[model samples]
Target: MSHQSGHQHHIWVQSHHPVKLEPKLPQPLPKEPTFYYFAYGSCMCPVDLKRSLGENTHHYVIGPSILQGYRLGFYVYSPTRKCGVLDIVPDPKASVKGVLYQLPWRLSEYLDKREGVAQGLYRHELVNIHCQDQVYQDVRTYIVVDKLAEEAAPNDWYFNVVLRGAVTCGLPEEYCWHLFNHMYNLQQRNQERQLRESA
Candidate 1:
């Protein structure tokens, strides 16, 4: 008898199967030392902040906040960006609206580097921030080391980024409009000056 006839034969088939995997959930941020930061400029944009901080910053954002006793100004010229950047100036009657963050302490050095702290382009200023019916004290922000005598216009790139950050981070609609007008007026003035100089 044939060897196959000694026992009942069984056929085994193998088939490729697709796996059903559960969607991955975002991991919670690691517990670590953190610091409160108030961003009034390009840093207000999480997209921009991520570029420097080397990580996503959206999770760190608290929300739109008010910096009382201060006003926003474009008093610093960035040679790197080739435009004027925002700075906070003391003004008792004015308030600056900006994004607040509770960033990991590890990001402090990166933020400092981005702010040009070592180069003295900006220096840290400790202040209070009001957000969501709470006052956060001793929050760190940056100010120009040497402010220009007159405000300077931001380039189109800077202008767009500032406005994008303001809107994306949910700053007040009125404040966003005011910011837009302020930048536009400065740009108009700059264009007129250029035309006159070239003529």
Candidate 2:
């Protein structure tokens, strides 16, 4: 099948069967039923998510959830925070505690912007999550592109924000502690360097 800009390439075709290109729609159509998102990072914080989505966030119903086979990690650098942001790393024996929210399908665009999709910093991916004995499939979440960023320790403010969100969502104390203690103290390390420089 021949590929072109803004055209759908056909997958099934034999030498005898000529490939028929599907015409592009003049306008995009909305797909239903609802949009569900899994927030494993600071987005799990209602305060942060509200700040990101503003009043649009009111359209969502949110609750605590768990994503298995992934663990919380600090690696996505936040220039504004001068530290790393939260990301989920795949692990065979670990799970990440997070929040699950359902919103109107249209609101995905807003969330996408907040996550810097256009900037190529993060991308939306669908994954399964478990909440309250229910398993949710095709729940979208933001994940950092591999090999695009260097791992860095999160600063105090960034770390606290993640901790606060985890606490707010009532994630297990053990998990919360692990999150709180696992991050590196780049701020402190810089302070020590400054002290040494002065001496």
Candidate 3:
């Protein structure tokens, strides 16, 4: 675990977000079948992922990776989390940084359930990811079925989990700062809107 030091800006949130340490090296694939997964949202956090998959996922992580031709947006409200959640939108000039995993096929159904695939909230998107100087093809990721017209603000919990995963997984420092600032700005704007409406 590396920490971001000497940064001028501070993340303004009322709660403590803990980042649990995980093994950097991924476990070798089993004799059973496996599939590649790229996670850009709360799923990036192995702790949260384990909660859904019902198993330890840290060992499944293939580390921080990049996805080209797509950018992140908070385009859907999650009834479960009661907040806006992440989605990937096509953007030719943009790229998303996230965690990549090679997971056993047994966990596939759980993963789909977590993404609300059965309810049609999200659908699989096969993509190519760049990891450790190599390009991985036909990786599975989820995208919003119906995106909001405008971006929405993520709640503090979702925001923190995302940042924790990014930092813990060793994403680029500059990209992490950009993510922090983007979410912070959205939260601040949302708060302001709420205050104005209340007044």
Candidate 4:
């Protein structure tokens, strides 16, 4: 990894209509959830998984230190708040030097809500992440926005949190500056759109 080096495997959430969001995706029974949840956001703040699963939680955060090349975006929208937090998927090429929350076979309502699995915006799936000098395979978690939608734009608040976390997580400045640069570009684009729309 060159810069970014970390990723957001955690999420933002709301209500879910699984059938609507996942027309073809297979649904996994929560009862059989023996996989780990790779947390990259607030869950990364601590081993919240341990709280949710008691002694069942395993592994602290390990990483390829997912560096640059991923874009953090939002899935669920909060109409009343006008701005939602970061919860989108990271680019596959981008790395998420994220914490792995190994969860036991029980439903964590807090995580389910946080990732919006209950909400239609995301559907749970198993994906492998590179971490701890080896390849981690078949871990399960929810991915928001089935296929990233094309927008000529992106979100401001969402990007800030990711950049802040990555930096706080100890990612270097050149890499951090790269994120800020991306933010600057998005801000410019939003301003341009607003100017045009107002006109």
Candidate 5:
């Protein structure tokens, strides 16, 4: 992707990296602190995020966004859902589409919690988002720190959440097609497994 003038983005080549703490907040949190968060997984779905983050989800204003130099992967295991979650792996040749949400800065801590950041599952990092023909710098996002040795395909319901969000946000049809094919294959295998279990 061509870099726009004055927009210098960090080149993240490592898929697994160390965790870092958020910058310490001043004694009194700024009133109405706001942040731009890039959601490239289930969080891309407002319903999914609100299920965990609660009703204040109204605070999020989402728009279609692109993350360059990365590819979405499903190696982040979720103990609660007993399935895999989405994470972006550094890919010099690919770009992933999702949603960019403007949210209150104070909610970052809660988001980190929802992402299991404190458990060393995922780490918070700054990502570059391209939206509205502009490059947004230092946008916050989560990256998996400990990926499962064997990648796990997401369940149908979970994958549907991402598919719905992608379509709702008007992502390119080509991208949606790619996800749809992947989901179809995974769902078929899962159904076969159910048959075997019943047998």
Candidate 6:
């Protein structure tokens, strides 16, 4: 698929290749701490993820998760309490595929901060979000709460980052098309609702 600059953006996350910390954090144990990052709304592109996980992060591009009936919602940009997660009903038949990254202990710390993993905003959980016979083993991932961003819909520029990254992650053409269609519809609905609430 050709790269286009619009609703869907294309960001390249560089690999700085930083050294991993030998001594992990005392509280967040890494004894069997495996990193499993879910990339549904964004975080799909390896390069972008690489920036967060560094070059040594191991990942499996498994996705199309049901989100367990949870929908993708936007919070205030990032590093904000306004961030929220949303509800999207799950269809056992329909799969929302994305990427899953498994990083080392040191890398996880960096992501923890980036994703607000410490403030109890994003909780780490293990899930089996895959199609066919594929299943992730002991994959730990963090999830954001939808209600936080319920009122703060992401702006076009921020959402574009997700769109662009998803495109580069090798999402199937059909799925990519669906994303475009869904994003448009969601944008319109969000606007109308905002107007009504204000009125």
Q: How many residue pairs clash per model?
A: 0, 0, 0, 15, 0, 17
Residue range 165-198, candidate 1, lDDT tens digits: 9999999999999999999999999999999999
- Using alpha carbons, what is the TM-score of model 3? 0.84
Q: List TM-scores for all candidates, in order.
A: 0.85, 0.73, 0.84, 0.55, 0.76, 0.59
Question: Model 4, 97: alpha-carbon shift in Å?
Answer: 5.0
What is the C-alpha lDDT profile of model 4 across 1-199, one tens digit per residue? 4333332211112124454546455655433555566655444444334453454333333432432334454434544224443344657575544455455455466566555565565566566665566666766555556543533233665555556555555555676676567557755776898999999
Model 6 Cα RMSD, 1 decimal:
13.3
lDDT of 6 at 65: 36
> Per-residue lDDT tens digits of candidate 3, residues 1-199?
1234323223322123223212343534555699999999898889999999999999999989999999989899888888889999999999999999999999999999999999989999999999999999999999999988977899999999999988888899999999999899889999999999999
**Top candidate (TM-score):** 1
Once superposed on the true structure, which residue ranges of model 6 sit more than 4 Å away at CA? 1-34, 54-94, 131-133, 146-152, 193-199
Residues 86-192 of candidate 5: C-alpha lDDT, one tens digit per residue: 88899999988888988876677889999898899999879899988989999998999987675577876788898887787778899899988866776677678
Model 1, stretches more than 4 Å misplaced?
A: 1-30
Lowest lDDT sum, 10 consecutive residues, model 6, at: 10-19
| Evaluation by lDDT, superior candidate among 1 and 3 | 1
List the candidate 4 regions with Cα displacement exceeding 4 Å: 1-35, 40-60, 63-81, 84-97, 103-107, 146-148, 152-157, 172-175
| Candidate 2 Cα outliers beyond 4 Å, as residue runs | 1-33, 56-61, 148-150, 184-199
State, as a TM-score between 0 and 1, how close model 1 is to the true structure: 0.85
List of clashing residue pairs for candidate 1: none
For each candidate in the order shown, give its overall lDDT on alpha carbons.
Answer: 0.90, 0.74, 0.89, 0.51, 0.79, 0.54
Ranking by TM-score: 1, 3, 5, 2, 6, 4
